[model samples]
Target: MDALPDTLPDAPGERLRIASYNIRKCLGTDRRRNPERTMRVIKRTAAEIAVLQEADRRLGDRPAALTPEVIAQASDYTPLPIAKNHVSLGWHGNAILVRPWIELEDLHHLDLPSFEPRGAVAADLRRDGQLLRVVGVHLGLRTPDRLRQLGAISDWLATQTRLPTLILGDFNEWSATAPLAPLKPDFNVLAPGPSFHARLRLAPLDRIAHCDLWEPARTGMLDEGEALRASDHLPIWGEFRLPG
Candidate 1:
């Protein structure tokens, strides 16, 4: 399995590694539910912040698919309390996990306009005096709804104080540009690589977009070991350097 580099060149800025993954509720392509294996793939990314889709079951209180105990045992990251209910880990199956040292200043759970129960989560985090905004979303299947969801997110961000921001998750859009128009003018949208249908690797549905305050360093998909079978969609990651 290929792991992302542990450290980057000691340049003039602070660096951050962020990743997005659709864990399919911890149900892998092998038709098995193994949250441990799913977390193993996440650990491989070595992301300081991870935006995850389908982290909880869809029905009946929406219980978390990846329990806190499993996450604690496998990694050093802590899951944000973005879920509305006590049983779930995220809102509408979208969750954010950050390293223990990162300070969470604020958070919001957005209810998107869609035919189904779809939502997004946003967090303001501070590390080493650098304040960053991160949004995690899992959009609807239809293109029109996806556009509307992005617009809603854009509108929400417009109301907040600007920071080095990142929006990442399973966008569920085939073309990275069209549906993501609302964010294009200010954010650099990137589809690291084909991450869907993990076994075949045919679509670039998972993506990360960042504002100009940060410079993109590297991005790629995790394709080896548990990553290949832990979920139907492989994890995609991005490394960015925030100027001091």
Candidate 2:
């Protein structure tokens, strides 16, 4: 779709391009989710904020910690560890990034019920005086798991008050089934997504949804040049304007 507005203007009025991608732990689905490839997809998006799924420090029972040194090697965005599984093994967790112009504050991770430690990372930022809440999330892989996770998410989101908010991630959704069921009443999912299995190129694996967007103006994937080198999954992006 069209480039996300250099700025997103809601009430008060801030502009930003937001995106989501499942980096497959920085390894391409083809093999070892390569961190180099993962970072490539990220830099190409030129988004103000991003939510990444499957970034790994370690996986399975032996969760590894993602060090600052690891993130610095691949991306320009600061990496924040938002959730870890029950054993405290932090192998995989949500990743959040804000562009240089956007200032972020109040970063926190949500602890949801699941075999995995699922979370929602949120921050407050300003663009020309319009304040907004932005969230980066990666829900559980199982249906019941996501359902439970969203419940806690909804409860917290209900308290957001007037600022426009964003929720982006690897929702693991293909059809309107479960994902839409719980969060649709409160938010809008940017359309025409197929973000996984990059070499094959299907978008079911990635998505961007929002609350308080006026017309839901555009939706698309970034797959050109350096973006292709980023990861197995493509980056999905969108734009929103205030209702007149």
Residue runs of model 2 more than 4 Å from their true location after superposition:
1-14, 29-33, 59-76, 80-92, 176-179, 213-215, 225-230
Q: Give the per-residue lDDT digits (tens) of candidate 2, residues 99-134.
A: 545666566666777887666677777655557777
Please give the TM-score that candidate 1 achieves against the real structure.
0.94
Q: Give model 2 RMSD, 1 decimal.
A: 4.8
Model 2 misses residue 71 by how many Å? 5.7
Off by over 4 Å in 1: 1-3, 6-13, 176-179
Q: Rate the local accuracy (lDDT) of all candidates.
A: 0.87, 0.62
Candidate 1 per-residue C-alpha lDDT over 70-149 given as tens digits, one digit per residue, 9 for 90 to 100 = 99998878999888888998888999888777789999988899988788899999977878899999989998898899
